[model samples]
Target: MRGRFARAARLAALLVLAGTVQAAPVHASEVAHPFTVLGTPDRRDVVTWGASADRTGDAVADRSYRLVVHTSVGGGDLRIRLSNAFGDRPVTFDSVYAGLRRDGAELVHGSNRPLTFSGARSVVVPAGGVALSDPLPGRLPAATDLVISIHTPDAAGPATGHWMAMQTSYATQGDHTAQESAGAWTETTGSWTYLDAVSVRPPTGTAAVVALGDSITDGWQSTSDLDRRWPDYLARRLSTAHTRVKGVANEGISGNKVLADGAGQSALNRLRRDVLSQPGVRTVFLFEGVNDIKAHTGVTAQDLIAGYREIAQRVHAAGKCVVASTVAPFKGWSEWDPAGEAVRQEVNTYLRGSGDFDAVTDFDHILRSPYDPERMLPFFDGGDHIHPNDKGMQAMADAVDLSRLDCAGRR
Candidate 1:
């Protein structure tokens, strides 16, 4: 095995390659069409933090929620999306505020700002729908802890939210969104409710990437609230890189797939809404398919390849690059078998050879064990051999060619 220091050096070299991609010219219409609220094609509302909502249930009425989401890019104006996509009845959030977090449940004094829907102070989101807040004017710094406080007074029926948030957000009873103090927030929840995405209006040229993957991208075994997921690390890298792609939204669900609907909608089905609909998105980082292969659903490499080709083609049609990744090795997991391993090898070969994608990152190369070609390196394995640990997560982030993420190449 190579020394850890040597490995780090080589990994850094790989990232240098990833970050060396040339500036791909973006059309004014590629990103401008989605921002009807601003009434111009110049808004840069890049998604900073996002969670894939799953399994709707009833929501408590007359409750206040202060959800904490981290931002990837900085800008003067901010907008948030509240979803009731899984509900069967109307859900109303009366008092909603956006503020900066100052430890625990406290908000930075005077940083709490109210968010409105359209011109109204409150709005009712119809069942299976989403509501976006009007742009609020302010300077939102990159990598800051943003708190979105919402009070749904008459909320009932199906509730849409991501269950494995990994981050700790506070909850309280009744309306407390206007308060910036911690006194009213006596409850805590691991999952984020109603709130799905937070975006900011950066410079007109700034761009963002949406990472669509499985639990590994969702930070399952990684430390909670630390923003240690691979995509989080990549965002940190992009913060200082010279590339225009400065924003990143992690859309990973715990058990998502590529060809079929399982955890969240299949990557193909949700691509438009979850990845492309957001403003200022320059690329779609597709890192799914492990769940599909490991699930033993009789999916073939050709089936997975067809899925990849479709994703790349659709992204190209949207005039955005699609950077796919080879699935990491998981032969030590309980689902590992010669048949599954064969499928993984075949798929990885395609990922490395198929010229259909704008770019490809061999996650399998950096994550697999030298001793056992098919298993995850012990250093990166998060016990289950499926998810990577914090160190492994960082390594994966380092493997990307940051430059390829912004290419203007067509499929």
Candidate 2:
């Protein structure tokens, strides 16, 4: 009896250590967190736009930023979330505004509006904290270029942001949050800083699905100025569908892993903040693991499967469904080998057969070439053979059955 107990204890310890990836502001919830509900019992606020936060460089002081992001669903009372997740000190934003973008560094004349934080014009977000803007009462259209301008007069710690936004945004030296002209904004950048999410109050029963992935979903190989990520394409599909999952949140990070924290905290580490913390989330669309499998770190099929099971379990525990996808083929990438290919096949087979997730999307089959079997189709290849081009991204989105994302099954 003593021996058996000791063995079980060791096994438990190993499981805990293997699953852990260090992230600040960790959640200890064994069940779904009862965060502040957005609306009354009849309606709710769903996440219309989201981007994962990673530890980039340091923040610049007295800088005015005009970040542009694309929204998935249309609703009223728009809200935005500013994150200082990796900062070591408090960062204060003295001025912030939201408006409809009109060309380079320009905003619609009457559409630029001020955003308050708890009824104040300014907000100070502490390290590892998020500040949600007070909802602006207005109609926001889906697939619109929503530009948010911010003035950070005092910020000098580690910056928290998404580095590969695949969208062009503007920055300058002064506080021009309410400007409609392109003059004040003089610099251009491809990353999205400080800002992370945008939410909106939708009609009754309108819910959302959050896509949790890596660079493929982050639009690495796709055209830079165009919103052509697989998740972006998926969002477009959800817009015209008659399903409850109208909103889509792209929570993907560039060069992110599932089992370790490299580019950002692993998927398991950031799941709570990036996926479950959002309002009215009904499903989590998970598509990751190539980095883990090809790291040449001896990550086996079982290891990847273990990660998938844990992700699905947590989502289910939160009363949400999981829509997992098989990892796409990367046979031509430099890291590919016989061992990695074997592991990929094993993982994909399990993803298709395992009954652990609520649903499965066969991304491997969709992206793989019929002739090569182990390679991506030439037309879809992004030169690296690991990522898919814009056309391939759209194909993956079109393959998804929009009805499967309906939240009715979860309810």
Candidate 3:
């Protein structure tokens, strides 16, 4: 009987040990968080809107700007990038906010949200540097007006901005970035200040296209506040199309050149910041060279071709495709001459025949008249004979093959 009792006690002790093992908690270090396992790897940020930054020469202290921008793709977690790229000293932004526009200088109710930087309310950007804001929560709709208000407490030196925004924005004094009404935003401006680019995270596999060109791509002749630029129209088309490349960024600068810097930076010099730095860009739409050709700076067809090839090589090295556009005819412009026209023709010929570019869009054919191949079609000309009107802009956007913009796996 004694032996039986001892065996039963031993069995009970073994049962208790088994229960303890089954109920053991996992060590915090041994198990991975669910978010770490399933969140970051598939998510990517794409540029929804961007403008090339240059010296504005309008620096001031204790000023606020209510800049309006248009988005190309809708997604959650919106972020904005401010530039001190042309400044001579560091600039501190004490307050910044993003909201949907209810009207001029007014924000949509309950939509305005504050943007933080590394969990701080302020960020200091050094000269020739850029600061990207921490992502704001919630989804931003595509093709909507996003109002960004910023205040610099000690803004001085050369201000960095896009001088020709073509969109009407507002400004005022003191810290009014937290205001959602237009009551305090009394002053008006035509350019976007400080803010250079905006981005958002879309679904995996989504991508973007950057249009690198001159005033035409910059919406020079298009109606202001109408979003009538060729790139804007292209963004609208991409939104409903089956292609995954929906994001569009216009990197065009007025009077910009492909070979030299005057308006902003040359295509070669600014390519890294304006084009390559944009996230999830699958293609670089090359539609420049008219300024270089017409300037009569002794740029030959060979020289222009070399520039194009260099741009193509650099873009390819970055694992992106290049879609070259033939320089459109501009005969009526004051700079038009037989010498420049001849160079333009030769360059177009090379752009058409050369396999250096991944694809080609014949903008010359689209905008030039069949009656006289050297001049723009009167219907599309924007009075200047160089820049195109809204109709012409839409036509240019329509000419792009949607499939070519989707350079997935074609790198």
TM per candidate comes to: 0.89, 0.90, 0.89
lDDT, candidate 1, residue 136? 70
Instruction: Give lDDT for model 2.
Output: 0.82
Which of candidates 1 and 2 reaches a greater lDDT? 2
Task: Count clashing residue pairs per candidate.
Answer: 6, 0, 0
Leading candidate by lDDT: 3
Tens digits of per-residue lDDT for model 3 on 313-346? 8888778898999999999999999999999999
RMSD of each: 10.2, 12.4, 15.5
- Model 2 misplaced regions, further than 4 Å: 1-43
The 10-residue segment of model 3 with minimum total lDDT is: 14-23
Candidate 3 lDDT (Cα, 0 to 1): 0.83
lDDT string for model 2 (41-88, tens) is 113678999999888798899998999998898777777888887888
The residue ranges of model 1 lying beyond 4 angstroms of the native Cα positions read 1-43, 409-411
